[model samples]
Target: MPNSANLGHKKKVFDLFAQKVLVVVGKGGTGRTTVARVLAELGTKTGRRVAVIAGTSGTHFLAKEDPLLSFSSLEPGQVLISYLYEHGLGQLGKRLSSTGLASIISTAIPGIADLLVLAKIKQMERSDAADLIIFDAPASGHFLRLIATPKGLADIAAAGPLRKQSREVLEMLDDPTRLGVAFVTIAEETPVKESIETMKQLKKSSGIVPCALFINSVLPSIPGNEKVQDLSFLESTSPYYQAAKYMRTRSQSQKHYEAMAAKAFGLKPIEVPLVPTVELSEDDITYLADIVELQIRSKK
Candidate 1:
């Protein structure tokens, strides 16, 4: 739970984590990973044990070089193998998925992999390791597949032990008090469109409305630039004029899409500024986290 004193009006933002899980979703390249990182840091700031679980492709955001042990990859292969170990297949678990046949078989199974994927997150929630878990979910399309696994499994294995397990996971997922979904997107067309589409499907299939929407990489307004229009006098061929003019036009365009995205999601989108760095450093991520910290307070 968020420490109210620490939040100091930031309660609503950070308090969402008290629910146990937040799965970050959006189209690829929309900075979902960055949003996850910011949220994780916020969790820690509010004095909760936070863990960032990323899909396979998102693992690199947490490097060995980084000292945070609170980050991990939600690889399905590892999930199945670990389940075996937990269920008394200890020795077999070690060598089972190591085999070529086992790898292909798990992949070939229709919903088995997705089952383990959700199961793994549920497993983390069930454990004592962390009180707050942030899943930097896979891309929108794949995330939809992952979210549907439990219900699909329930329909097929209605009476077996598999069905029982599915029921337990579904209970957690279906209960918004236990799990929350958040979308990460930019103020661009494709990502916002995909996000809205996914948001609709997510609500229809999972019965969970997103807890929040984060619009990443928004341009910060330069002084006197937000309203600037007639810059043709500086010489249209000049790179300086072109850059300023482009920024002005693009910034305005982003504001339009930002408003549309917020309206479509029916939630105010938290805007994160674009960083002027080649690669994000810890300082950069911290800066972003600080910016996002405002969202919590404002909403509170």
Candidate 2:
């Protein structure tokens, strides 16, 4: 049996997992997939059923054998077919797809593919298919359009199933308790700038802001009082000394950008340190998850 304090901590830790949907987006190469994977793994630690749905990528990097964590990726063509079937247009969907007309149709209708994909996610939420659904979205620019599709359609359609579906999705976007959005960025000028701009666009387009921002691959500072100037003589003779100086310089640079990001987003960013590994092992993910759990716990 757990003590009162232990139980309370557990509840606080899992409060983030209580959200029905979490959407992650970032500039390419910022490790949005890694964050999604870690979130899914953490949710399973508490016996929650978690699934990661990829918008433009595959979920093969996730733990395939984990019973509590399921994975899926969305292909527009397939989603459109299934969506048509669900909405009573199976025959037409089949005819268009079989003759390669589906691509043309999708291109002709802006946001149709996005709407269909969102409809599938909406269905999964309604049917209780998973306790937590994490959507690994495309690059931030594309994601802005993906999320804005529902409202655009709703505004244009006066009365129809299309309008009804659009309104439902908009409701999900507006509900913070049901849906949480997070952005990831590296400690660099371009990514930091793009993240701020994209976040502002999301707010302008939907009146919704990200719940959290994560700064990935932050260099950990080494403890030392010895200045690089004091070690200049050794740096001329030793590669090891040169490497240390480079890292110290890089770490300082990262801090500069990290502070800029925090001020622009108006949220203290969660920093995931750069792991010293050629390939991330399970332990590395667990270590990062511990950071996320502690951060959430502190807030609670």
Candidate 3:
């Protein structure tokens, strides 16, 4: 879609994460999870300790396999219900219940206590035990809310433990050395346009700019040759011929969109080809990894 050359000319965002944390975000179905998973695998391969966490349902696909990368899903413990049950009821239950009324209630509801403890364990597993945590976050619309939660909660709990927790999350967001966000998009009008808007909102709301823009499902340039011209001449031959022409035209349009987006963002777009099937096999992931390695090497 956009100009590959224009994207190629910009600085690589991976340079920013030489020894830091990175978070990938994008609209749904833009392959943000795949890119995040690949990055986690790459980090582990390079001898960096890596952990991948997902705040949405689709992220479970990444954890299904025995990852060369360490992985966890955050959805289980991210909700208000889960948070209250876990940290409030379970982990802090006995202590809070040390106050007679709380103790009597917690003791009475054994089922509630188990649920709370399980949730706390899950939350800690998602957030605390990672060297490089790759958060396969919720889609763009929900991501803004997710990032804003800390500040909102902090304002409400200015002098409590919740305030301290909020401060820690805020510090993670503000520390460039500790956290960075990546926005994945396709070389299409809707996704690219939304990605730009997401980046703007992220900066305005959280003071965090997306460090990278990944353009997925790029069509490689068709080689120039006499045969290609002959194929073009056959555009009116049949419906099949017309379909081929339409495909080429779409590719060209996508390239233009990608180039324009790159120029607007002042960042290089990481291009990933559109594979035919929806599900990617391990071999496919490995192939993609090779392409990523080349892109990174070229930057070096």
Clashes of each: 0, 0, 8
Residue-level lDDT of model 2, residues 1-300, one tens digit each, is: 000111122221235554698888887799988888888878888999998888784544746578899989875566765666766766665655542555665666656666667767887888878999988876635446757544665653345666777777778888878887888999899999988888887878777767777778877766651376677568465886777778777877777777777777766567777787987878888888887777656645
lDDT of 1 by residue, 89-128 (tens): 7766565544454466465555555566777788888998
Each model's TM-score, in the order given? 0.83, 0.85, 0.76
lDDT (Cα atoms) of all candidates against the true structure: 0.71, 0.73, 0.62
| Best candidate according to lDDT | 2
Better of 1 and 2 by lDDT: 2
Q: What is candidate 3's local distance difference test score?
A: 0.62
User: RMSD of model 3, in Å?
Assistant: 7.0
Between candidates 1 and 3, the lDDT winner: 1
TM-score of 1: 0.83
Between candidates 1 and 3, name the one with more favorable TM-score.
1
Off by over 4 Å in 1: 1-15, 62-69, 81-108, 148-150, 156-160, 230-233
Which candidate leads in TM-score? 2
In candidate 1, list every pair of residues with a backbone clash: none
